[model samples]
Target: MPLPRLARGASGRPAAAPRVRLPREIKVLLAAAFVIALGYGLVAPVLPQFAASFDVGVAAASVIVSVFAFTRLIFAPTSGSLTARLGERKVYVSGVLIVALSTGACAFAQNYWQLLLYRGLGGIGSTMFTVSAMALLVRLAPPDGRGRVSSAYAGTFLMGGILGPVAGGLLAGWGLRVPFLVYAAALVVAAAVVAVMLREPRNAAGGDGTAASPPMTVREALADGTYRASLVSAFANGWATFGVRMSLIPLFAGAVLLAGPSTAGLALAVFAVGNAAALTFSGRLADTLGRKPMVITGLVVTGLALGAVGFTDNVPLFVVLSVVAGFGSGLLNPSQQAAVADVVGNERNGGKVLATFQMATDAGAILGPVLAGALADRLSYGWAFAATGAILLVSALVWLAFGRETLIREPQLQQRPDGTA
Candidate 1:
């Protein structure tokens, strides 16, 4: 069915505000995201801990986390269409409520299956919230400023990476369920912020300035050739960046540096630092350099970093390589998202595109680890890194061979601090 032709996006605007201007609307969005991130992070580290309580091993406990990713993979396609139909204001709020209730239920979970059920439910709601947020950023932020604005949104996850572990560790010590309750409260606060602070009455109208209607479903989203390519690219990127960085690198560290898991953790932290640092500038560069430029650069460099990791026996050398690889990761996300918005066009479709992309994320994570795991069991950790690196390189080649630059309506011009146009 056709979506309602309201002139506005689900964000309740024709498009988001300019990237150059940090408005109250954007702040509310970011603030809510921060709260959500905090709540979510507060429990993340303890997933394994929580599951172990039921006498489940590490692998089964991991399912609690993986189940969420898998569920999100399923929901991603529909999330965009739902946003188009219902509008972000409604979906975002309801998603938070769902997360709250689901997480709260886990507190009462008497068994591993119950915990898995609740976590999976929360995962569904998470897709709704995440997709809605990304969709709104695409709809609300102007074309030229997309890279920059998207950077801010991406930064939230990175920030959460840093803080969530610490918070989760502390809260879990208090009791596993205690963090779940705290997370619930945090979502409520985030929901209230959105309800009260973020409003643009004009955008309530869909394409024709009428009532918002549902946009295309995942079925329609998958039909698009360009969207499919983006998903494939996302899979390649995720598999290489995450699967290896988390699982394979430690083995390499152990082999080369004679260090343990702690060293591998440090290596991962270094990669994140590189990602965070690059994000500070990469977004602006994407605006100036074009989205495709960053995309290609990110892919090529990340692949090279993975390749570099294979050659290194020196710990410091690998650290540098890890940083480079992380920077590559930082560059990949925003540019790809901007490209999705470009191909799909702004409005409710942004939500759907993100959902599809997230599926690729899950696929990469699931498959990457399996592939890496197999390589490790059979050959060596080195082979695993090399294989992922090769895939990264292949991703770049594919993009260069077939990937097209997303059409930007405007050339983002840099302005002098003096305000010279």
Candidate 2:
């Protein structure tokens, strides 16, 4: 679907306010995200346990999780280059296809090593899709519209995350490998949808028309205070939400809460519900409200909620805390993404910037599981959660000290009477 053109003012700037109606390209992308996340969520509850079916310890099982992120972290730079050269649509579809094949292969793996290899290979594809998708979205959205766009994307994934786990828990009863097959099928379908439905919303020729400027270099982006702060925020978000939430929460459920697989899935689903609920509103608010305050508030909330989760033994309390943490995550993520978009602007290629941003998150994800798993093994789950919470607190402190607002404004910084200009 084509997006309506933005009206221009007498001064030749966009005069229209951001609209709530999303463009077709973004809508289709959100659908694809939902399906992909749905499939992954199905597998999330079972992946570690399935790996441990080979008689490995907790740390080794975590290797299966970390290996996927390790590959994504290493390959993200290359994937960004590919997205830049080939355009996002082609790279995005190809990436999904690779992951589909890899996930299908994973279903039949007879040993831990085989599972590790297949999962790790899938990570390369994951990076390709992720970087491309983010680049595409950032490119297409108007400056004022980025927050809502980011939220819509994240919201769709959260919706899938909510539904996939319950279904996965039910399917897990059939076999540990069943969810992998299902996930592979889902990815294939998502790939087909992307291939058929995805188009550059603005230009038929495939450019968004805004990326005409020379692409920003990674070093340049890092120099910006806002982008630097976003990296820290992304790292903490990944460490807690992507890494430990998926890997350790289930283990904690079993060991502490005395819940079974179904309950663990329920906890994950509840968390997604909380995230989804907040995301719909958070994006629009971020667009109007400034990025820094929302992000700072979210970090504090997530940190406190995550820390609380470690101490709760009641299943209801755990689920409630997870939901609260997810809400905080939903609040933080869209704003962080919008801040990056704000810095990169519409004139520069976002591939490298998006890739670097992704790598920061992947760095935390790659390390979190291994470290948390070791910590859990040596000390306790509470300590592991505490460590993850501490990371968020530190991230908040970093933002408070060094972060600058990235939302585009018409006025320059006000000069003070003392000496500052």
Candidate 3:
């Protein structure tokens, strides 16, 4: 007799249907993200300049930027709690709606403080959606495919990131405020699609066959060494990728490399291209080899690349190095996300844990720019870039010392006695 075919799932239940493609819910989530991201991208190029339109000084205008992170930091715990109570679907949709409203309101703000308030409100919504989306993705995906699934999710954001600024620039030609209204509309459309298309997975919705393990607590998750390493890595990822890249790279291109705006733009585009390309393969590598090795390799490569970018004055070389650094980041991200999902491990109430992980990144993004910019002003661009590299290196060291491989292969558990797992 021939052996029976089996399906993969949390309870090892045989699938009723063959899953030749990614799950429908996952596709829906990615679609929603792409649309939302597109709108977000549309607004990114104009936000800072819009804030300055109120006749505020540069420092005051910058407050508009910082307040978003500050609000996200403060609301993270609450966002997690809501996710646990309301479930990811409700929370995700509601959060998107809130963000849409707030972002639209920003277009009408007549003064600097008004813009700041609206932007801050949007931050809270942003956190709500971000944490809930992560919680949903982790819960829905099978353990074996976590890395690839995360890469897909990340890819949607990259698509949005790539297209948004370009679209935003074109919309700016119409009016500075036009993009905000369009972004708000795009967000609404995204929320509606998610509402229509997304149904919670059977496992996550407490279906008939399997009872889930008790959800892990924030305190418990924090005590785990792997989780701690994730936090460290998350912090560094945010610092280097989000914080330093945006705030300092342009200045380095302009002042240090003696490059023009076009060169700076090209450098950013190159980095994004590298990042997108790596996302395609890195996730599969993480699934096959393991999360720890990929993450460590990415960190080391990124650190060395950043350090090298600092010492060189050649613009072309700088662009090349930035692309290399971005590729390293691409390798690191999916693995890091997969590792956290491993620790989360079928828990229902992972919102708080995910929130905490996200908070670490937000905190790094919030702090990195101010500190790095101060260093660049006082010392030099080279020193600032080098210091950022050092932080990433330290984060990698932390992971090396404390992190462990987290991919849980199902076959290993099946090999144990009684088939009772």
Candidate 4:
């Protein structure tokens, strides 16, 4: 597929600027991402409640949630190796089918142990597809359009995430197991779409069109300062966004603000709204301006806003800060992913490199809550929020000091015969 091109003026002259037009394969990936995220969201809101229904205590029920992330972290290396060996399309399809089977099994679980086992198995599949998907994006995205592609992809998942929970709540009226069945069906549909529509890129060949470049290794990738800095920022992002936001925000809303469940849900919804607003333009800025500036700016904005969140007693102020924090995250994500793509380039497979980066994020998500919760218990919620904010700020400092901009300027980008830049 062709990358984006400059539109022509009325007189057939090239326009002064180029516009990003996503290639067909990326659109396919985006479609599959939406389905996958929507299905996952359907399961997420109800998973704890479903586990509790098995006559388990709160701690045990929460463990069901933790185990999935734990398994994803543990199995990531293996997933990377599989993606490298079998290719992304194969791993992606196989991974989706495995998750589908596991989710369907969850619907039929007769006991807590069964549910736990099924959910844990789903994590293995999650890492498999997640790693392959990143590798595929690295391969397929047009060089100049990587940020825009990442943004569109993230936006689709965000839209699905915003819609899925509401739908899951309605489906729960029917039964908890119904959502699992529905999620399983959604996974099957996503797998079918990708399996049918997405074609794997042929191996990068030499002038003779016979030999392919070797896959990029993690060791080689680590030599780049940008990748190393990205790991720090990725960890901070996982810590603040996935871990603390989900775990701490609701508690703060209920305990500190003395708000109802609806209020807490509203805060989350507003964050998503702010995130959507930023996605509208941040990607284009990243593509046109630079990745480093976006990353640093996002981290600073998120840190400052989130750090102040615990100091505020007013509900309106809390909600506004949440929105600001979400906006910062939206600005950060696409540029971060695009920078990684730049490092990997289009010619070489980077499954292991991508997996290692993913592992850093997963590790932060796994550890952040446990540590922050302890701080909340011993110190205060303020300390927990501040600590998370501090981590983000420190990461921004790392980027400022050491990170390199990875966006390839037009003059520097070289297009191959295959039309890749």
CA-lDDT, candidates in order = 0.77, 0.85, 0.86, 0.89
Candidate 1: segments with Cα more than 4 A from true spot: 1-19, 200-228, 255-257, 407-421
- Say which prediction, candidate 1 or candidate 4, comes out ahead on TM-score: 4
Model 1 global lDDT (CA atoms, 0 to 1): 0.77
Using TM-score as the yardstick, the better of models 3 and 4 is 4
Best model per lDDT? 4
Per-residue CA lDDT of model 4 for 1-421, tens digit only, reads 2223334445554332258677788889999999988888898889999999999999999999999999999999999999888888999999999999999999999999999999999999999999999999889988878888888988999999988888899899999999999999999999999999998865667346788778889999998888999999999999988898888999999999999888788888888998899999888877877788899999999888888887889899999999999999999999998989989999888999999999999998988998999999999999999999999999999998878888755443446899998
The alpha-carbon deviation from the true structure for residue 162 of candidate 1, after best TM-score superposition, in angstroms, is 0.7
Give per-model TM-scores. Answer: 0.86, 0.82, 0.90, 0.93
Q: Residue-wise lDDT of candidate 2 within 266-360, one digit each (tens)?
A: 88777778788889888877776667878998898899888788889799999999999989988999988988888877655678889989999
Q: What TM-score would you give candidate 3 relative to the actual structure?
A: 0.90
* TM-score, ranked from best to worst: 4, 3, 1, 2
Which residues of candidate 4, in runs, are more than 4 Å off?
Answer: 1-17, 206-208, 412-421
Candidate 1 C-alpha lDDT tens digits along 244-363: 677678877887678888878888999989899888988777665566668878888898898778778888898899999999989887887777776655544456557777778778
lDDT (Cα, 0-100) at 84 in candidate 1: 67
The ten-residue window of minimal lDDT in model 3 covers: 1-10
Best by TM-score: 4
lDDT score, candidate 1, position 375: 85
Q: Judge candidate 3 against the unseen true structure and give its global Cα lDDT, from 0 to 1.
A: 0.86
